[model samples]
Target: KLVVNPEKIKSLKDVKGKKIATPQLGNTQDVAFLNWISEQGWKVDAESGKGDVSVVRTDNKITPDAYKSGSIDGAWVPEPTASKLVSEGAKVLLDEADLWPDKKFVITNVIVRQDFLKEHPEAVEAVLRASVRTNRWIEDNPEKAKAAANAQLKTDTGKALPSDVLDPAWQSIQVTDDPLAATLDTEADHAVEAGLLEKPDLTGIYDLTPLNKVLKAEGEPEVDDAGLGVE
Candidate 1:
């Protein structure tokens, strides 16, 4: 999502010439923002993050502070970070999801080392089964899931998310079993077009058989690997 101080910007056009932060240089969010900027007929150096718009590579942990300090006008950030900025008086200017088809895109991925996967196929399938069930559980009981997530967060970070942040943040997420492989391929294309990445083969990058097996057992529809699955 793209969040800005309401006092400073009112519309997408106002984003021109503003210092916008992305989570990291050449990351998924950075590539998407760059692609959007290009679509606006604007120019920005992909590597240095300078031009008509300043793409500041700020860490999510410090982005709200950067905005509060007036160092950045807005941020194209992921969940909790976006919600946290909103709590500090930032208004959502645009949702990145709106730009994609059906407002769906991949935000996270689970990767397993090929060697480990080959040796521990059963373990891999077990993990996928657990993940599928957990996603469904989260969807079925959102409030309980939120509380449980906050509890885990507290254990890790020494504090739980405040309702102001947690509520909106939780609302923005979509827990899905699909890997959204096609969108990931599109993201790579966007990065290449923005000069942040080179075109490269992505064949055999996915192996969704184990996931599909779990989904089938759970009485769910199977997912495709966007033709990038291992042969």
Candidate 2:
């Protein structure tokens, strides 16, 4: 999501010549933001993060502080940071989800070393089963899941998101067993367009059989790997 200080910036075009921040120069959100800028006919040196709009590569830990202090006008970030900025009075200018088909995209994915998978297929299946069950539980009981996730976040980070931030951030995310492979391919293309990556040969990049097996056992439809699945 792109969260902006509404009092300072009202629209996408208004962002030109303003200061904006991304977590890091070559990270996923940074690449996406750079690609969007190029699409707008705005010039930004992908490597230097300079040109029309100053792209400040701020660390996520201090991004909210930067925004609060008016050091940056807006940010392209993922949740809970996006929600944290909202708590600080930032308004979401873009959802990113809205830009994709069906409003679904990959934010996180699970990958195991090829050797580990080959030697421990059963272990992989067990993990997939747990993943499927956990996703279903979250879907069936969203409020409780949110609380549980907040508890874990607090344990890990020494702070829990306040309800105002947690509620919307949790709502924006989707938990599912599917890897949403097509969107992963699209994201790679976005990075390429932003000059962050060369055209990647993604053949055999997925081994979804284990995930599909678990899904079928749960009476769910299988997910496609966008023709990049192991044959």
Candidate 3:
């Protein structure tokens, strides 16, 4: 579907002056869309320095409802919720996975307090260790992955998620605790390439030593990069 969803969304020009629903202004998706609107040469506000696309501020869960009631044109929603909305009657005008060909998207990520990492270094190691195994498990077991995901999200949604939503999300993701630096080396590259940042000077962003030490102790097999997302 990455190949199917073109980066140049057709008829977004039709949306000039129309409300573009998003989770939050200046959050990643908002930034991406604003950049795109600028690229399209539409009128942007001088004072706010934002795009011509009217930003419809809403929570992620409420966005589909906003769309249904004709309050917003479309939303920057995460899967399986995004695709679920389409199934329930809202149209999927732009699926980002389909929009950016040969590129992948990052969905959920784990964030820990800096103090937590500093104080409980061993705990961090355990988490990464469990994550390594979990990552491997997800790669090896798609059915279980879907079941776990559906259980986590679908019960909240009150319906079975179409596999189309879960399949792509699962395939495009990995579960791991690779040192943030190693992960961000690739992430920074993608982020910069996407014009999200000028450059990511990863000075205080991550530390890899604790995780490396854990891997050493575990005699962990070097995981292949093929299935796991983004190196």
Candidate 4:
């Protein structure tokens, strides 16, 4: 989501000349934001992150503090962090998902070392099965899943998200097994437009057989790899 300080921005046009943040220079969100800015007829130096707008590459964990300190006026950030900024008086001016068809985009995906996968196909299948089952569980019991997720976060990170930040962030997410591969391809194009990447072959970038097998066994529709899967 693109969140802004309500006091500073009244609308998207107001974002011009404002200081905005992304997780890292040349990262996914940064590329997307740069592409959007270019489409708006704005010019920016992608590497230095300077021009019509200031693209501060701040880590998500400290984004809320950056916002509070007025180091940034807004951020193109992922959840919990987005909600945290909202808690600090930021307004969600745009949901990036809405920019894509059907309001769907890739937030995360599983990746494994090719050698490890080849040596342990069974283990790969098991991980995919677990992921599929967890997505289904989240769909079936959202509240319970949220609680479990918070508990796990606390266990792993030593702190849990507060309900005020957790609830809305959880509600905004759509857990799925598909991976939305086409969106990844599109994001690569965004990177190219942002001058962060060159056009290159992405053929055979995915090995979705394990994922499809897990889905088939679970009686769920299989997913495609946007023609980038191993033939």
Candidate number of the best lDDT: 1
lDDT for each of the candidates?
0.94, 0.91, 0.56, 0.92
TM, every model: 0.98, 0.97, 0.67, 0.97
Error of 2 at 106 (Å): 1.1
- 1-231: candidate 3 lDDT, tens digit per residue: 101112223354565666666566455565555545665777555224345666665687777677667676666655555664555555556555454434444444545687998799778878877876676677788788779878877578687666766675555454554432343345555445445567755555544555556666777644322223321
**Which residues of candidate 3, in runs, are more than 4 Å off?**
1-10, 43-51, 89-102, 105-107, 154-202, 214-231
Q: Higher-TM-score candidate among 2 and 3?
A: 2
Which residue ranges in model 4 land beyond 4 Å of their true spot?
none
Clashes of each: 0, 0, 1, 0
Question: After superposition on all CA atoms, how large is the RMSD of candidate 3?
Answer: 6.2
Q: Any idea what lDDT model 3 has? A: 0.56
Poorest 10 consecutive residues by lDDT, candidate 3:
1-10
Q: Pick the candidate with the highest TM-score.
A: 1
List, residue by residue over 1-231, the lDDT tens digit for candidate 1: 999988888999999889999999988899999999999999999999999999999999999999999999999999899999999999999999999999998878888999988999999999999999999999999999999999999999999999999999999999999999999899999999999788968889999988999999999999999988999
lDDT of 2 by residue, 56-150 (tens): 99998999999999999999999989999999999999988888899988878889999999999999999989999999899999999999999
Candidate number with the higher TM-score (1 or 4): 1
